[model samples]
Target: MTSNDATRQALIVRGGWDGHQPVETTDSMIPFLERNGFAVRVEESTAIYADADYLATVDLILQVNTMSTIEKDEFAGLQAAVLNGTGMAGWHGGIADSYRNNADYLHMIGGQFAHHAGKDPAERTGEQSDNYIPYTVHISELGKTHPITQGIDDFDLVTEQYWVLSDEYNDVLATTTQSVRPWDAWNRPVTAPAIWTRQWGKGRIFVSAPGHRLEIIENPNVRTIIERGLLWAAR
Candidate 1:
């Protein structure tokens, strides 16, 4: 790619826990990426991350792998690429919960998925949906003006609301509050970041906590946030 080039390259490395539907979710984003002038490459393994030469030419990386382990050299390659200005972006468990054993990866992302608050036991149905609840994603004052979230009003959805363990390095855009009930462990309501961005070295990392499945990803607001995030994070 040249300075005057109009097209940029995107690398999509997906595949991990099948529950997150990594393939389908990432597949849906391909056409959108192409339409935005990105030459997309989809790889199923982390092997491509170790290919420094190839990574050098990539302007953006959309990682959809969840709860997977990344090899040391492969992780190093990824870290180096970002440090040198490759943008990284992903959503839900894919970006926030991937590579549990690697603290370095977490350090780069600036947040981790702790758990999804479940409904009261009396209302639980012994299904995954037990964790799904109606919640509102509140836009922060900063978010109201940020390019990714501007003009997007706070929205409500019934889904798995994530409780993320995050640090101050992240620029929080939107948040969801987990209310305290008799059945819950926490004392008071806890507000967790639902959308955030981190500046790592020369790269920008964008994360959205709402996309647990295709339906959630396709939500008009969620889709717009992600689309804008991809372009915002690109090198």
Candidate 2:
């Protein structure tokens, strides 16, 4: 587990749907990664996904691209790199909504963005509305002692608590209850993962679905989680 700063390499791939402010969010995280001793690389295209030579040298990847197309080989190369022991860490759509059509990518990442209550058809399309309800994120019992969620108490935020499509493989660390309301009604309330971790081959995968905006990255608890998650996922 002893890693030298000089040898640890990280790649930041940024560029996709601008609404998510992919580059800005990625920029918000770079200084933190650099301070943690990783030699970080920033790229604007998924084309970097196909560079096997470069992928082979990376220890961790910070993907900030959202809703983008990834070519077959490019996707395969990323999967292979992680399977070979590289780590993958990211937040929100950048990680969960990256490739809509790639199932392998979804399986490896362990979840996908199904919808946020605010984005439901019934709710009017406006960023600031009742649709954006204030909710609290509770750390699961399993997360109480986990390094990522340690010392973090239940916190409330006025943002989209993403309802995700997940699996049994994830070690869910935090979750929130989805309340059924007229504007965004569900048959019943369902608890969904707010943060989680999983593995693929030798790779470590970490995801936090809270930082949809750059401000969310500034949340002390959220920032701490991502910082710790990045280190934990690193090879």
Candidate 3:
């Protein structure tokens, strides 16, 4: 189909570490997009860079990869596509934690997965990990009424609660407060954003810090949040 006739095309990039279970996670997302009338193309290899022209034709980009780097030209094309109105959306460390060497990429994403505080300290290296714990997310005042979060009740999750250091300009959708433990040496409590969306040029970025495992993404509330975030972030 021609570019004008391909409004439903979506590019799903899946690679990097197996811990994120890129293949399985992205496989699970196919039906959801299909149901929503999206013609999804799952690219397990990063060779899409060889044909940068084709990547620009997609309407939405969902990255399920983690801790991998892309060539500068390939990364630039994707960034430009999003900035020019293509939707960019992902959950957890896949998208947010990707392209650590590319500052321009981080600028497009709006925030980076900094650290996680819980039982799995050493395992929680970089952006992706198996740090599961029960926590509550407090909807940000600005996002309490946003479409991505409207009518969603405050929820709890037994998953990795990300402590993301975000750009001050982000439109925070929701946040989870991290309470200080009595045994912990840190004197003050820290509050972190659990989910957020931000506008970059003519495009959009949506991120949620949950998907550590298939079970976590299987949660009804988490599913809804991810679905809504995908739609909300689409241009």
Candidate 4:
């Protein structure tokens, strides 16, 4: 497909932990955005967040960034743009774990990655506890009707069960449960959100917790949800 620079604009700012393969993950989504009529640009730095005037011109932001610190003004500009109607979407730690110290950013995104209950994959030199665990996601009744999740059934992922500090504001679409194990500090299976959408002013926010690796992101249902979610979020 040809780039339609006049249709819409998107910015993908990616970096932080290499374990998440931010570059590769962000690269994989460029074609989707382009195919959907967005002229996408990739950036390696969060400094782009400081450019409010330029940000105002963007229609969407797909961030595959991780625990990178954001300058106060840069963070502020990002919040302003989203609140002013620029759509935001991301998966896993890229969106949920960004900026450990930025509360406003978390509020806009609607959640924060607390910690993964499982050990990290041995191949990666990052945080390790429980790296891979099989879990099933149950689609909510609302999800069956929501455009982002329409026709997608409940699926399973053998990745980390993200235990996020999320609020009730999100329009949850799917959920997963963590059965209490000997390693768990708490007993009883706990259900947590796997996919959700939220609003920040006039902008749309979509998040999915399953994309820990390229394979998971490439899953048919995962790809469809992410693609449709981004398109839906865009102005």
The number of the candidate with the highest lDDT is 1
RMSD of each: 2.5, 3.1, 3.7, 2.7
Regions of candidate 1 where Cα sits further than 4 Å from its true position: 1-6
Total clashing pairs in model 1: 0
Local lDDT at 159 for model 1? 92
Tens-place lDDT digits, model 3, residues 1-235:
1133344888888888788777777777777877776788888865674466786677778887788888887877887788788888888888878878888888888888887666645555555434566789787777678988888888888777888877787888888877676645567888777888878888888888888767777888778888888877766
User: In candidate 1, residue 41 scores what lDDT?
Assistant: 89
Ranking of all predicted structures according to lDDT, beginning with the best and ending with the worst: 1, 2, 4, 3
Candidate 2 residue spans exceeding 4 A from truth: 1-5, 119-125, 128-131
Report the CA-based lDDT of candidate 3 relative to the real structure.
0.78
* TM-score leader: 1
Model 4's alpha-carbon lDDT is 0.86
Q: How displaced is residue 8 in candidate 2, in Å?
A: 0.8
Total backbone clashes of candidate 3, pairs 3 or more residues apart or in separate chains: 0
After best superposition, candidate 2 residue 60: deviation in angstroms? 0.7
Cα lDDT tens digits, model 1, 92-211, are: 999999999899999999989998988889989898799889999999999999999999999998999999999988999999999988888899999999999999999999999999
Worst 10-residue stretch by lDDT in candidate 3?
A: 1-10
TM values, all candidates:
0.96, 0.93, 0.88, 0.93
Model 4 poorest 10 in a row by lDDT: 120-129
lDDT of 2 by residue, 1-235 (tens): 2235656899999888887788888888777777788888899998998999899999999998899989999998999999999999999889999999899999999989888776455556655443466788999998999999988999988777789999999999999888886655578888889999998999999999888777788888888999899999998
Candidates in order have lDDT scores of: 0.93, 0.87, 0.78, 0.86
